[model samples]
Target: MLMGSCKSLKKVNTVSIRTTKPRKISPEAQNLYKRLQETTKKGYAFGHQDATAYGIGWKNDGTLFKTDVHEITGQHPAVHGFDIGHLELEWEYNLDTVPFALIQDQIKKIHQKGGIVTVSWHASNPISGEDSWNRRGKPIKKLLPGRRLHRTYKTWLATIASFFNDIKDDQGRPIPIIFRPFHEMNKPWFWWGKGKCSADEYKMLWRETVDLLTHEFSVDQLLFAYSPDAFDNREAYLEYYPGDDVVDILGMDLYQHWTAKSFSKNLNDGLKVIAQLGKEKQKLYALTESGLEKVRISDWWTKVIDQQLAHSGITWALFWRNARKSHHFVSYPGHKSATDFMHLAQKDYVLFLDDIVPIEVSSEAQ
Candidate 1:
């Protein structure tokens, strides 16, 4: 009895270090990180912008003619894309402008269905309520610290933070989001684009925004993506990169700017450049946005996108929206290219709904 009592006292005094305890990364973020690591070992995922909320070829006519991925190919895309352009202006959820409440619901549904969501922002020039390309406003420097719009920018970031915070699954855990802000900055069109601000200024803006969203707001559910337009080489692409620490994903938006024959070559070269950079930096990379607007080529999916992505260690490639019949990316049922797209969807390397690894929904319902 004395020996047993002595052993119990010793057990109470000893403390375990638990060296194998996993870091407290959010479940969604951890799932995405593991999947990205596995995707390089597996294959790339396919995505589409504004896919479920709306589509070009057809709309829900109360029948079997919804042209979103499932309606056309019997499966939803592995990734769903959204944008927050009009939210800064505090507008209701419109076609491109996703209001907070609507987005929250959409995120829940998509997550429940075992899919991923990526978001982009086309923040209007804060000085002018015009489009994103409106250069009539002051330099991007004005939005950084110690400037007139700095306070306004903080309010915008708070709004975005609140929006993301509201995005909770059934268990109330924040959903993992790939937040790509100020995309296509390498192009001199948007207010934050090149020629509008110096590289140092742009980097400051990016870092400051990230610090605000991550540190200040304590939002750990987001994976920041730095995306630029297609550049000739790595030097040009990395010119505006914020830093390795701030960015979790490296992506580039490449559209078919040249003729059909040159489309594959241009996109392939850009992908090669991004792939090399991602490998060197040890970051996940994606074709954040691309599409032959109107998709004139019947085999564009296989010949252009698939051919270029072949053997590339890309995580995902998201095509632009199918807004209207005149300007659409994916083909509708009975469309000339729909058959070719079916082949693309069924390929061993390309992944769609059934092919994607399922994300574990929070078992703790909130």
Candidate 2:
């Protein structure tokens, strides 16, 4: 009895250290950090943005869309290694068979294979409002914005926090899930985006959502991100800017297969904006979402991005679809590619995993 009591008392008085507590770094993270150094100089001169240079990863539509998970993961040729991973939850994807609770198990699967998980948390969408946007299911359009239905946002958010609350990496530390919400808000349509709410409303929603998750739910594990769609002009970028405090990284979703000139223009415009933003705000920039429409065609897979790699602002770029031809998400629905497409085989692009880290136990949240 005295030994047990003494041990318990010692536990209460002892200061915990990372040395005593095992710090198991995931192999994916280990390689990613290694690649970060290998791919760049010690100083900040960006390189010719080769897609393969930095990091490579893919987004899995979580539901078990492919019953044979092995067939999908690592089998795709476009995604090779060390890119950040995403276990996205959309009505079109997995969330049907497995509940949100089981997501960590699958994330573990990805991590075991050496990859980081980017948790896809849709902000407000037409089918689901903020209040109704948790992993449960989408809400009706009419029930969004203001009123009791909106309050459901808190309930659902709490549910999500409780769900991810216990998730840990291989080392038992919380998995560094980059929670990207309201991505591409500049795209006027999506619920939590331009069409549904005014800029002020959007900012308020963001602030409120961050407050709810960061404060109320105690989701200290999340790395808050804002990814806007690639813009034709730089104005759209400014339109959705959530300011310095809220956004962690700047990114865009684009397809190099779209028309070489136009696509190049948009991406360059984005790079310029990022350069300016990075200079002023001190933030890291990335082509968060990217892809070529056709599997066998074009250097766009690398040309568009690495062209600006030598610049200090841009860090990483992750392709949209896997190497598989059928599951190609290159150009959304109805946007077909021309037959006999030209392919750029020696693609080089960077996946800047080393640029912005997710967290460092930021003062233990609130």
TM-score list, all predictions: 0.87, 0.60
Which candidate leads in TM-score?
1
- Clash numbers, per candidate: 0, 24
Candidate 2 regions off by >4 Å?
A: 1-102, 109-114, 123-146, 232-235, 296-298, 302-313, 329-366
- Per-candidate RMSD vs. true structure? 10.8, 12.8
lDDT per residue (tens digit) for residues 41-136 in model 1: 668888888777667544432232133667667888888888888677777764354355656676677777777889999888887767788977
For candidate 2, the per-residue lDDT at 220 reads 57
TM-score quality measure for candidate 1: 0.87
Highest-lDDT candidate: 1
Estimate every model's Cα lDDT from 0 to 1.
0.74, 0.44
lDDT by residue (tens digit), candidate 2, 1-366: 000011111111222110111122333333433333333322221111111221113333444312111222212121121211122223222222223434556555544443344544544333432321332332322233454456666665666666556677667756555556667767655555555555544554565565566666666555555678877555777676644555555666666656667877777777787767656665555566665544334343345544544454454545543333464433222223311111222222222222223212222222
